[model samples]
Target: MVEMTGIVDVAARAGVSVATVSRALRGLPGVSDATREQIRQIAAELGYVASPSAAALPTGRTGAVAVVSPVATTGWYFNAVCEGAQEVLAANGFDVLRYDLSEVETNRRRVFDTQLLRKRVDALLLTSLPLTPEEVEALHAMNRPVMVVGPIVSGLPSVRIDDVEVGRMATEHLVGLGHREIAFAGGDPDDQLGFPVSPDRRIGYAEVLREVGVEPDPALTVPAKFTVEAGVAAFAELWARDVRPTALFAASDEVAMGAMHEARRHGVRIPEDLSVVGVDDHDMSWLFGLTTVAQDVRAEGRIAAGTLLEALRSGIAGETTVTTVPTELIVRSSTRPAGQSAS
Candidate 1:
């Protein structure tokens, strides 16, 4: 039998006190982020297994769930999902520990490599984060229940919508309105977190165009940061082109709102001059009269949280299941037939 690494060994390797190591490993507030990370790295290298008694409560569990999100909780989708998840978790007597990584490589690495392994959370809820194979394996090695809220990662249970189908619905709506010269405004395909939705949506858009015998125009596709400001700038670039599109398909409602604002600034009429469609029926979609493909993001979060809770109660780990949320196209007054005059 091999020897197990002890806390003192980890403390010695990391050049920190045993108490400091304890604080760091438990994710307490006393230790600095850098020091905590170093201690965790050393513990992993030393193959330290935290004593179950070190993290156990009177109830025999931490009673906390870690919710990992790649971005801040400002966006509508993120905020709604978090709200829904929090509601369910809180009702079930579990506290949520939110870890917003800002889609930074170092932050993501630290969370996956060290913080998660600290055994502070009973389960993990990953929201819209694309994990590498190694990261997934690390989570598996933890032997704790894990749930995903967006984009399926192989061998993990997830709750999400068919992003490709979402893109197709948006594009099909534009095509049905007699739009031939159409543009796409969406998130960068190469974002730091490796999010697959942006690229998947782009693929769906291109596929629809090809099916209709229309060659997808590379020049009309613009990558942005999935924010209203980014959408405005992207639309400006498209407007600068000599051959402007008659309609645009924004990847999200915020982007569509930005495009509409930009068009208004340029004295361009909506529907008459340029029709705009987007995904996600944002709160302001009705105010802007924007057409969009809508999904219940908050409901997805609730379901994801519930799923994790179920797995935890059953004491089963690594049982893969997939739950797909549905989406629908909501047609407002934003889109009209191509070449139609303003009423």
Candidate 2:
């Protein structure tokens, strides 16, 4: 038997008309729910892979999008975002291709310049990866729409929290409880990209310090990678210092947990001896009774997907807009007034 290669084949297998098949495949209006499902199932069973050139020849779309992250498998943030984007994209008849670049320049160039990126995807969803000036320009030049989660690129529609504000918010929460000497626990500010996050968050911490008439002390600032071990190491290093902070504003929940562990080892008490606050409300934050600023990663992901869909349907590309998600302080048993020491 011979195989058919166009809308006719899909329609034949789905028991629908060519027009109905087109509508279902393109996610256009005027198709019944049952018809859409039938068409999709038929397409899948037939092993029918749409050629980008062929698909675009008629509809000018590849029916797919690229989701590029420093790492899509990032603890919670990236995973939630990818889930949200996939939910929306798949529902709209667009498939997702995930790529984890992890900040390797060589891998990045290969992903961008090779067949992996060659017109296979109609758009891109960038999650928390800092694209160099040239990279941003290159995506712009490709003329594909790009939606980002966390921080903004020069000309990309992005969904992000005001990370500086997030940092400040966490700090102010602690300061309101009368924490005078506070320290930051995270990666080195001078490191590459520092992702802009480390520094922006630190600024918020500094702002609160200055607001409370406390001069910024470099000695109080601690640096570590965004990992549990890094957090542990940073806290241990700070513990060795003659002047330990009465409070800590950890960059992430993982860091916060590390600090809590080290504090316990040194016979320091939580909320009693030290007040702690962190960002990301990570999975273990609650388990450890950690206070944190919670941003809905899942909701951010869903909204990003919606924004990208709007752009795709409206034929808009390269419109860089910032969407800020709010953060909430979840007060718990981990913080208290400075004078309370359990050591």
Candidate 3:
């Protein structure tokens, strides 16, 4: 009996997974152009024949949009955006399938390394994710419309606020009010998830600080994930510093509220001992009288979804359009001029 050369041999020779070999041979979108060509050549050389099951591509519309997040998708912003998007997509007779990696490597690989990203949705909506060059190529090859929220990518349609402007606006408000030593607590400064929101805002804040001759202090920035508890921890980190900031610019209202909560515990008074500001005029921002740079989060989601729907209707499958939303600074009692008592 002669051993037969199979798809496995082709995949091994091509240094790709069996699934990738199948996708490349079947003319699916997940495989990049270069990789697909390489796989084809290798398969032909090996005389590999794909079974009918392996070659068949699914037909018709999925009636769904994929909402992918590089990290966890349980934050207030994520929820609000999805709610707005769902309201629009549901009304339009489509479903939203979410794939949140929760910052886990396995989940991330599973979503990106397989057909999960390419086959299951008519369109894709990414939340603050920046992809690799290969990933971008794969997306382009798939030929589906892709939209992003909270980050900008070349050739990709996105709906997000001008994050740099949001940061500059927040920082300028604090600076204008005579608060010099402003601390920031928001997304990770390292930005391991590779989203533009944090970095762009960081740039804005730094620019504002530089214009006023105040250097941005690395000690004052904290990676407070967008949550109240994370905010509390981040504020504690800031309070522990030898030269604490008199004013804090939290990236979100939840962080501001949590920081405020922690401030009270340490006998530091809001606006009196330490002025604070945040982005995202969350519902609770009003309850806490928290001043924030407010972006219409739900409306952003709606706009993102609506754009994807338009692409579906028009058979447009590229990430070329960008819809920018407006952001407003809402003043409340949480921030005030740094008083003499503040140190």
Which candidate wins on TM-score?
Answer: 2
Report the lDDT tens digits of candidate 2 across residue range 1-343. 5764766777787777877876787688888888788888888887665556676767657788888877433456677788888998898878898888866877799667734574678788888877777777777777777788887766778888887898889899988988889988876544665376767888998998899999978888889756677778888989787667889998888788888898889888887888888888886789889999888877888888888788787986635779999999999989888876744
The alpha-carbon deviation from the true structure for residue 133 of candidate 1, after best TM-score superposition, in angstroms, is 2.5
Model 3: which ten-residue window has the lowest total lDDT? 51-60
Each model's TM-score, in the order given? 0.79, 0.84, 0.77
Return the lDDT, model 2, position 251: 85
Alpha-carbon shift of residue 221 in model 2 (angstroms): 0.4
lDDT (Cα, tens digit) per residue for candidate 1, span 27-58:
88999999999998988888887765555754
Which model, 2 or 3, shows the larger lDDT? 3
**Candidate closest to the true structure, highest lDDT:** 1
Candidate 3: tens digits of C-alpha lDDT, residues 167-271? 999999999999888998888655544766766787899999999998998997888867788789988887787657889988778888899999889888888
Task: Report the Cα RMSD per candidate.
Answer: 12.1, 4.2, 13.1
Q: After superposition, how far is residue 31 of candidate 1 from its true place, in Å?
A: 43
- Worst ten in a row by lDDT for model 2: 187-196
Q: In model 1, what are the clashing residue pairs, if there are any?
A: none
